[model samples]
Target: MKHLSILVPDDRSGPNTVACIAGTYHAFTEANKYYGTLGRKPVFKMELVGLSKRSELVNGMLMIQPQASISTIRKTDLIIIPALGGEFLEKNFVDEKVSAWLRGQYKKGAEIACMCTGAYMLAATDLLNGKSCSVHWKSAESFHQLFPEVQLKIEKLITDEEGIYTNGGGYSFLNLLIYLIGKYYDRQTAVYCSKVLQVEIDRQTQSDFAIFSGQKKHGDDMIRKAQEYMEHNYDRKISVDELSKELAFGRRTFDRRFIKATGNTPAEYLQRLKIESAKKALESTPKTVNEIMYEVGYSDAKAFREVFRKITGISPLAYKNKYNREAAELLFMNDAN
Candidate 1:
C-alpha cells in the first residue's frame, strides 16, 4: 500500500478545489471500511497539505501543514494537486519555491496527479511537454494559448504513461479518485464509495465526445443564452414557447438549437436544473419535499419524485434517509476497519 500526499495550492482557487481532494480521502477511508471484508487491509494512506494562508503548520486529523519545505516533500510516494489558479501564471511570479520543488519531485520518479486547472502547474513544470493532458473545458483554450508545446486532449480525463494524470474538472476529479481507489482495492470498493457519495460513476474517464453531442459545440452563442434563461427562471414553470420568444427564435428552431447545444430538450434540461435545485434544498433547507417541489416549479408530487428518482436513482425521501444512514455507517465502519 502506498501512502499518498495531496498538495493543495494556497491561492484563491484552493478553497473550491480542496473539496475534491477531501472527497477522495473520505472515499478511500469509507471504501476500506465497507469493502475490506476480504481480510486484506486497505492499501493506501492519505495526507493533505495546504499551501495557502500562511507558512504555518495547522495540525488536524486530515489536514497537514502548509509550511513544508519542498525538500521535505521528497519522501511522498504520490503527489496529488487539487487545483492551481491563474495566479500561478500571473505576470508576477508566485509560489516559485514550491513550484521548483514540485519539479524536483517529478524528476525523482514521483507520480503526479492533477485535477482541473491544476494541470496548469504541471504545464509550468515543462515535464508535460510531450505528454497529453486534459484541463477544464472552460480553461482549455487559455491553457493552449499559453503553453503550445503540451498536447491537450479534449477528454473528460487523461492519465498518461509518464505518470502524469490530469482531469477535466471537479466531477472528473471525483471520477478519477474512484478510478484510483478501484485500481488499488477492487470494483466493489469503488462502487460502494460511489454509492456512499451519491454519485453514479461507471466510466473510467471522461470521453472526448462528451464535450460535444448532437453535432453541437455546446458553446454556441444561442445555446448559452437559452441556458442562461433557464438558470434565471429555475423557479418558474418555463414553457418552450416562452423560451423561444424570449430568445427571439421560433419554437422549432429553439428546440433544435437547445438540443444541439446541450444534447437535451429544453424541458429535460430545465427539469434537471430543477431537480438539482431541489437537491440543494433537501440538503440545506428545512422545507418539506412538497414545498420544495412547488418551489422548484414541480406542481405534482408524484411527477417530481419520479423525475428526481430518474436523475439520481433514488427517491427524495430515500435519498435523504440513505445519506444519513450511509454517513453514520461509514463512521462506524471506519472505526471498525
Candidate 2:
C-alpha cells in the first residue's frame, strides 16, 4: 500500500475554519492507525502558504506562522482547501501567488478538494462553472448569487465528478473520507477508520436525517422529557412502565405521545438507538463483533449481524474489510508517489 499525501489549508474564521481542518485531521489520523499496523504510514505535512498572520475579530483569535511557504503544497497529491473565518465566502479572490501555485498544481493533475466556502477559491479559478457541486445550505443562497455559473447541490453531503470535489459543509468531511476510503480501499476500511475516530457509523448516504433536518422543533414537552431519559439510560434495561412513572404520565399516555412525537415507539426507539451506538462501537474499537453486539444490547452475535445488515445494507465484516483495503491502497499510492 502507498501513503496518501493530503495538504490542509489554514486561514483565520465564524467562517468554520477549525471544523474543516478538524475533519481532515480526523480522517488522516484514523487512516494512519490501521495503515501503521501493516507497516505503511501516510505522510502528513501541513503548510501555511499566504497571509503570515490571520486573525478574526469575532472569533477573538489570531494565527501567526513564522515560516509560511507554499513549497510543501506544490508537491502534494491531494490539496484540501478549508474555509477561513467568517469572511471566507464574502472575501475577494486569494492573493496571486497562492492562486497561481494552486492552479499550477491542479494543472498538473493533483486532486483538489474544498469544503464549504473553500469552494469559493475553486470557483475563482473558473474551473467549476456549470459543474455540480455542494455548498453548505446556509450559504447556498448567497453562493448562488455570487457564482451563478456553478450548479449547487445542497441536499447531498459531497459532490465528486471529474478531478475536483466539493463538500456541502464542514461536517460532510466524514462522508468525504468514507467515500475516499471506499474508492481507494473498500468499505470496511472506512468503517474501521470511522470506528477508530469514535464517529457513529452512518449508513445513510443522504445528509438530511430527520433528527437533523431543518427547523429544530421542540416537540411536546412530555415527549422531550421521555426522550431525554431514554438517551441517558440506553445502557440500562428500562421499561415503558419505568418511563411512565418517572415522567408523571400514565403508561398509556407515555406510549401514545412518545410514539407520536418521535415517530417510533419506546421499545423500537431504544432498539434503533442501541443499534446506532453498537455501530459506532464496531468501528472505533478493536473489540470483536460479538463483544460489541453484546455491549449494545444484543445477546446473540448472529442476530446482531443480521440486524446490522438490515439497517446498514452491509455486514459488519464487509464494512471493516472495505475500509482496511482503502487505507492500504492510499498508503501504497502515497508511498509510490
Least accurate stretch of 10 residues (summed lDDT) in model 2?
207-216
Summarize candidate 1's per-residue lDDT along 41-96 as a digit string, tens digits: 76766666544533222222134345454446556667777765444344224377
Task: Assess candidate 2 and give its lDDT.
Answer: 0.63
Candidate 2 structure quality by residue, lDDT tens digits, 96-147: 6667777888787767777777788777776788887887766665666567
Q: Rate the local accuracy (lDDT) of all candidates.
A: 0.68, 0.63
TM-score of model 1 relative to the true fold? 0.54
Candidate 1 residue runs with Cα over 4 Å from true position = 34-36, 50-70, 86-94, 204-337
RMSD of candidates 1 onward, in order:
10.3, 13.8
Model 1 scores what on Cα lDDT? 0.68
In candidate 1, list every pair of residues with a backbone clash: 10-52, 156-206
Best by TM-score: 1
